[model samples]
Target chain A: MSIFVDENTKVIVQGLTGGQGKFHGLRNRDYGTKIVGGVTPGKGGTDVDGIPVFNTVKEAVEATGATASFVSVPPKFAADAIMEAAAGGIKFIVCITEGIPAHDEAIVFNRLVEEFPGVRLLGPNCPGIISPGKCNIGITSGDIALAGGPVGIVSRSGTLTYQALHELSQQGIGQTTCVGIGGDPVPGTNFIDCLAAFEADPETKAVMMIGEIGGSEEERAAEWIKHNMTKPVVSYVAGVTAPPGRKMGHAGAIISGSKGTAQAKMDALREAGVHVCLNPTEAGQKMVEIVKAL
Target chain B: MDLFEYQGKQYFSRFGIAVSPGDVADTVEEAVAVAERVGYPVVVKAQVKVGGRGKAGGVKLADNIDEVRLHAGNILGLDIKGHVVHRLWIERSSDIAKEYYASFTLDRPNKMHLGMLSAQGGVEIEVVAEENPDAIAFLSIDPVRGLDLGTARRWVADAELDEVAREQTAELLVKLYDCYTTGDCDLAEINPLILTPDNKVHALDAKVTLDENASFRHPEWEEFRATETEDPREKMAKEKGLNYIGLDGTVGIIANGAGLAMSTLDVVNQVGGSAANFLDIGGGANADVMASALEVINSDPKVKVIFVNIFGGITRVDEVAKGVLEALKRVTISSPIVLRLDGTNAVEGRAILAPHLNEKLITEPTMLDAARRAVAFANA
Candidate 1:
């Protein structure tokens, strides 16, 4: 079984009439995800690609019994979409919109914690999650992933996640689940959250984590891995050659006042007994080695 | 999107917060005129984004017109922390009976708006937090609930500010919170929230960072963008809507995502080659986008070899390959190109490129092999 999503995870699409929503909704459905319905305000009684549409998330959830949602709205309306999903009792929400203001994200995050305690929010600028053969949600290409493998992958990047998944699948290493937590300054799910889930999954023999320069999340994850993780984990931190104080494409990938650097993160992971790879291919190879030893 | 102190003060004033009367000047004559208008005992402050302006002699009190001329002339071209000062903010100096600190920024870990209020101000808050942790009062404000007058009052009292300064400081804090939220700022800081002998409270200095994402809502931000200084390559890339950062190296690197683009840079370094820039095409690998990206990279004269690494997920490798060929036809690039195509129709993509393969255009099978070939070509 995969973590977070699987065949039983019924999904609803937010902003289904929009360009990205329609395109990825069809892709997710094609990948075997149970996209039961969609939500578009004032477009109830409509259908997008054979899926029912409703005026609100609550109505969509009521009609289709959808447990999860994919938020593909514009940045201005993304916070309200997340709130509507939470208010409609969606257990998991994956947001794929980028360029959302940090203050708006702050409000959504605080409301999720105070109002909806058990719900999980994945990303505001990420490529969602894919559990391989079972189901694919969000934007990650499903063909590159293998199902029910011994490895679990979590990353902060979209294309980098694809690179790692492709490398592992080429090496005949399948995955239980691959999660992209996104590259925003504030993400709902972090490395530690995914690592904990991977550690608990009995089918997952090893975990591969992909991080970039920014924040102290990697260092904190290293602390968590040292104390609690029982499975072997390999990791890669991007931006080793990046200049300090310049943001490297990602909003969260800035080195501020010597606080977040690639060397510091790599050193922290090494101290926790984690094998840190220098590049993406090496990261995939390191995961293969750890899984073989297991 | 970091605002200069003068710009931050302008924003604070819009929210009804008290700030010392100031006007920006670009030359010594303009500085003298601003000083004369603002009255004597003006502060000639160099306007730079970096800190330590006072210690770097970019800040000086001018009691007379000649002093204003002298100070403004020196501070205008002064180098503070590697930032050459090109502007000065001339303001009537305030009488400080006490200095306090207050700021609002996002607390990433807690996912809330964090407000820091301290009676110990005028110095770096980091030092206060490190040396006397209890001197500063930290409060996490729910972005939904927001900061009210009662909460601001209690926060001011908890910071142990003088009783005479409490009421006005609380009111100013509420206004500052309004400026922070309604202003769409990532950070709104008053390093020296001062109280004068007359028990008046006002902001002595402002440090603000506006949220660039919120530019859609605030069209007035065009003024801020007009004053920004950026690298030529970065500016061109921004105009082309490509995610790019200029660096001082030889190998120009391009990829599909931020993470992979960064990893490409690292792998180039690991293979004994340095990257000239970091460019992320971001899921759009069509002809126009690829041509624009190539044009931006080719504009940099230091680049000897261009590495185009594409790992197509939602993006198809065939579309990327076609885009690369189409872009090659549009621009005359001096650097040799090393291409790596993988995932989702990679075979078809490679076949599409096989006919175009020559001494200048080369494709590798793997990321490592592609990086090695690119580095070797760059050195050669």
Candidate 2:
């Protein structure tokens, strides 16, 4: 029922010996995700809490047949890790690493698109994706999510994405898949990719997209939804009170000139026939109403 | 990390891009000395990071040392768009034959390096893109392939640069592109890239925003810190590893993520209380991060109520609850704190803080209710 990941998906962790990688890697494994192997470059022939560790993604993939990779390397080497995963024949890569340079992301993104056509990347600074009751691939807490749902979620923000899940689950709503596209200027997956996936997934009855200030991503997604989406869509673009040129915590969540404002995004989404809310709580309530009707 | 005009010129020169001879000065005497060195007909430009400097009288043409002294003294204390001009860029001014524009920035939608070149420069590129779309030549260069001299020449021709200027402009564009990529700049811009009366090409003005993320690779970026806007609250928060933006408001906000932090600020404003700052503790709201956040917020005299809104996912609420308690123990908070904790381990989290619930340390189950209480406290 999930768009990208399910119970059948096998995952590998890059930089599994590192603190963040070990913490999230074991956590996801405990959540019933098939975290089969880990890669830590020279930490080969060892096991991190029962998950086999290999020296390279290529070796991890060859041994464990890991279809997806969870990247938790440092920012400087993040792009190289992603490319390594792509080269290792991993179809899906979820990079949880933050602070990757935009140029590096741009170069890697283009290369991935051109050379690794089969690979699907989630983030360079994202919370990663979760398929409720099936498999948890990234760092999102599994407890907040409910299994077997009529909704799919996509978000640009980390805590906001969790908030959406918590709100839905609080209202006794379950989700099919939740994607955090990351707030970086250059994200591997965008709103349109998630929206299109949700549209095609029969299990996903509705979509809740959470966007923030910065970049023309939300507006572009609204345009794509206007022409493409068939399912009911509810959205909340954060940072209405955000002033221009102020980097609002997130690297990508800043209003540049008159572009990427919360107001502009909301206006565009509303114009696209999506129910746009001023705040996240209202957006969740609106989604609940839409889901109840469905 | 927006570089001042002189700094931008220096950065451009690092990459072999031709910019006018310029030097930065903090005092009128220093400005006159730089003008003397750079020669007469110098531009005494205020080094504030804002637009409309000319309209604000921050930019003045000085033909002699006395004029430089007068203009520099007047411009130093000038306020342009809330930025006080504390420094001036004294440069030998070029006689402009034609003004053009060129820049390289990330194309968010296309996921490529976007090169914008316009025949019409010396104006906001957005204005040119809106009023005369055809006048601006947009080039989407793949980051892997990058911009080459051949493509830059073609791009300049497409932008319809003057025949005499195209060759030098193209070569300059290639150098600027290098400064953009290899030099680790977010934006390498030359507004009114001037074609000199002598048929030479050089950047008349520069607007460079260095990529902060790339700072790890460039230890040399520490030199750029001299021009940074000094906000003590922001400086402290940054030192403590917090993502913070100081605002002029009563409610000091702390959240787990940027989106949530911004929303918290908006909610505070909506509840009739303004936000004093936007602080994000990022993924993990551990004891250290929480303590630093509270310390920073407490240091702000304008903050009446510190609103910590945490919707924990990867960051467990129980851990956050413990962190908040630990932080409160470490930092003496002057303002009343209103905390809204939810999501993973929320029940246990609230239970963890059950003993400390009081008038000063308050907890609300939802964000709205907490915001209202915080705003009420701020108003009170």
Candidate 3:
């Protein structure tokens, strides 16, 4: 019942010959995702962990009828690879490359809208999306995640989710989908975008939103939740008083001018009826408290 | 990533944008020679990355070679917005009848191509655009088709560019887009795109920021980049392959986790004090990185106190504590350091750090208490 991907979803690995793609693909296959095919430019007809590989995404899709693609190309080639997959009619794309150029991402983002409206690109530098209890198409360590419950975890920080999940698992609670979303200066999915998807998913009864400094995405998402969310949401804004000039978490995770700080986001979330957790360790407990109250 | 006006103009010239003939001059003699070559009544512009040069007396009009020398001498050594003026651009002066501004940048997160156009150009268009956002129009260009001439013409016309000025501005738009994409530029701005009294259009000033990620394709830019003056702290951080940014604060922060580093900052402010900088040794924070971080922090005189917060996961607390001790040995700590080490062998780590504990080195039980005590000590 999770959003994005799950057990029955068929997946393709776009750079399957690469180290990361192969590693995550094996894990994805073990997590019950149907590994239909893979694309690795000149590595067609090859088999990676028994999954068939093709030269292009179009060929891979045609041969295996694959719907989703997990792209693991380098940052420099990420946009072009994603665009190629999009052109091939891949519906869901999870790009796991980090440090792509801002202008190149701009072009890819623009192309996503104009050329591939049917495709949903998850990340250029993100910790790919997962639809727990369904399929795992991301880089998240599956052993840490338990396939039960309806809580959605959306965060800009990857390690915080790991910590939060550790705490949640201790409480016998699990997530429907825990998305890292990545902390690049630019991301394909913002907190607001993830929030909308979570809101629409009936399986997700509660949400643990972890945000950091650097941008108004969290503030805007909090505002959106204040007026829209029906589910109990617990928020944690990480970086309230960050060092003046350091970009620590995600590239886009910066506190500048009047937007995107932990305090500002906390205030916004509080106004929206969200129980903002002050400590990362208390996030699961706080969400549990809110769920009990509900 | 920020480029000075002269560098930007050279990049713009590669795109065929009509700009007044100009040359960069570092000395008064060079300025006079450039002005004479351009046939005087030249404009002497300070070559600095920041805006507001016009109001800072960084821009001046010289009617003769003597006046060029006078303006160049005053500007070449001046400082504008913390950037010391090392060079000036001498260009044939254009008679301005009107001013307009345009820029191409990537809108964060949404990751879309952003085009900002303002009829009220020059003198900090950001302020004017903010005060009256309606006056500046924005367009998100589609990446596949790029920016078309029709769209460019429509945008200029919407911004109130006269019929005669439309073609030149439209041509400039295509060129700007080409420069933005091909140059791998994060930002390309032209302020005061002058509408000459003769109806000719010219780009009077240019600012371009290249995307550092795409620098691999531009080997020539490597030299230009090295020549550009950067914050010493940032330069040191970059040289060490560390991601560090200097902030105006008294408490120096060192954290293992990015989220924790940020939370450490929040906790500091919540308790009462400011953070000096955001230094995340990342998951790879070891004795070497820590020692280097200490040196970088020490370089900044603003850092009066230090805070080390580590919630060790994959990273061992004992390892981080060892790194701290190692760093302390190599670097003299005139300011007090408050450490809050938790998770993964924290007790053992604290025991290891016990020997190093003194007036300069302090340990707190939790992040909150550590931040509070650090701020207290910093102010003291």
Candidate 4:
């Protein structure tokens, strides 16, 4: 069983009328995702490539038995959309919008814990989780991802996952699922969360984790890997000796204090017994090498 | 997205917080005039988008016109922690009987609206907070309810504000909350919220940072675009809309993936060379985007060599190869480029890039070899 999405995950799309929602929804439908319906408020009667649209998430969930939702709403309204989806009883919600306000994100994060204690949030500015060969729930490019493997790929970047998968595929490596966890400072699911899923999956033999500059999340995850990861793990933390004060791509990719740096993360990973690759291309190769040795 | 003291205090004034009347000046002549208008004992504060200005000697108090000119002239041209002071804010200095501080900001990854209040205020609040974290009162404001008057009052008391300062402090707290919420600020800080001999509180300094995501709501930001003193590389990146940050390394990196770009830097150092910069072409790895990324990298004089690493998934390898070739044709390159193309349409991509192959545009099948070559070339 995959960690987030599976065969029984009946899905609904918020902002189905928007360009991204429609694109991913059509792809998901094509890939056999149980996209039961969509919600676009005023565009209720309209359908996104044959998926029925309702006025609100509550109505859509009640009518179609949708258990998961994909939110492609704008950043301004993303938090509201998540809350509405959670209140509507969507078990797993994936938000693909970028640049959400920090305060709005804080409110939503607090609400998720204080209000909807059971709902699982995939991302507010992240590529959604996917139970590969079963369901694809995020906006990560489908063409690059291939099903069937003992490897699981989790990353803080969307394009990096694609690149990693591409390199892995060239070496005849396939993954159970590849997750682009997004690079926003405030993300729904973190490395630790993804690691837990990869570790639990019997099909995943080893995990490839791609991290970048900013935040102590990678270091914390490295600490976790040192103690808990049952399967072999190959990792890469980006931005080695990067300029101290530059915003390195992601808003989350800033190195401020002593906690978040490539060296710090690399040290932690090394201490944890995880096979750390210094390069993106080597991440997949290292994963293969570890699996071969095992 | 960051506001200077004068601009932040303008917002503070809206919510009834007493702040010294001030004006921002871009020229030396205007700076002198503003200081004259504000009268003697004026505070010349640097107009930068960052904090710690006072510690950086960006803040100076002048009792006369000559001192004002000198301070404004020095502060205006100074670069404090990479943020250049383009303007000087001249304000009538306030008499301080006591100094107190308050600020609100997001706790980043924790995703909480964190508020900090302290009886000891000034430029040294950061150091004090670090050394004595519990000495300052911290509160997490609930998003739904927000920071109410009662919560602000409790925070003030916990921060050890004197009983005499509580009333004016509460009033200032409301203004701070308004600035934080209504202004869509990433940070709103008032240091040295001074208690005067008249028992009134005045904001001696205002620091506010706007949330970049919320720029859509404020159309007026278009008028305040100050790009002159921005890091040339950073400004160029801003223009192209590609996320770029210049580094001191020689290995110039161009990647479609942020994580990959970051990892490429690490790998460059691992193989014994520093990275020149972090450049991400985003999901759009087309020739145009690649060209922009290349242009940005080429603009950096420190970039002795280049690394073009693309794993084509959403971004086609063929497209990236074409982008590299197309960009190479447009710009004269002083540095060598190490290209590693893998993934979808890899055979075709390599073929397209094969003709453009030169001593500078070298291709490797593996990342390790490519990094080694790039780093070695950079050092050479």
Alpha-carbon lDDT, every model: 0.92, 0.91, 0.80, 0.80
**Which candidate wins on DockQ?**
2
What tens digits encode model 3's per-residue C-alpha lDDT throughout A71-175? 898887888898998899788888878778777776677678776787887777666666655777866655556667668888887656666665676567778
Candidate 2 C-alpha lDDT tens digits along B1-380: 88888888888898998888889899999998899888999999988778899999998999998899889989998889889999998899899889999999998889989999999998899989889999999999999999899999999999999999999999998899999999888899999899988999999899999889899998878988855886899999888888888989989999988889988988887779999988888887999999999999999999899999999887889999999999888988888888999988889999999999888999997898999999999999
How large an RMSD does model 1 have? Answer: 1.8
Model 2, A226: alpha-carbon shift in Å?
2.2
| Candidate 1: tens digits of C-alpha lDDT, residues A63-124 | 99999999999999999999999999899999999999888888888889899989999998
Best by lDDT: 1
Candidate 4 residue pairs in backbone clash: A150-A205, A238-B262, A238-B263, A239-B262
Tell me, by TM-score, which candidate is best.
2
CAPRI-wise, candidate 3 is acceptable
Give the Å shift of residue A215 in candidate 1: 1.8
Clash pairs detected, candidate 2 = none
Worst 10 residues of 1 chain A by lDDT: A285-294
Better of 3 and 4 by TM-score: 4
Model 3 misses residue B63 by how many Å?
2.5
Write down the C-alpha DockQ for each prediction: 0.79, 0.84, 0.44, 0.61
Please list the residue runs of candidate 3 whose C-alpha ends up more than 4 Å from where it truly belongs after superposition.
Answer: A8-12, A16-39, A43-67, A87-90, A114-118, A130-147, A166-173, A213-216, A242-249, A254-267, A277-285, A292-294, B107-111, B130-134, B256-260, B310-380
Supply candidate 4's per-residue lDDT for B360: 78
lDDT of 3 by residue, B1-380 (tens): 67778888888988898889989888899999899999878999988877678899999999987788779989987988788999888999888898988899766645667898878887577687679888787888765568989999899888877778889888888999999988988779898788998898888988887877788778868757866787788899879877776778898988865676777777788777998887778766688998888888888899998898876654678999999988877888778889988665678999999987998899998677888899999888
Model 3 has how many clashing residue pairs? 11
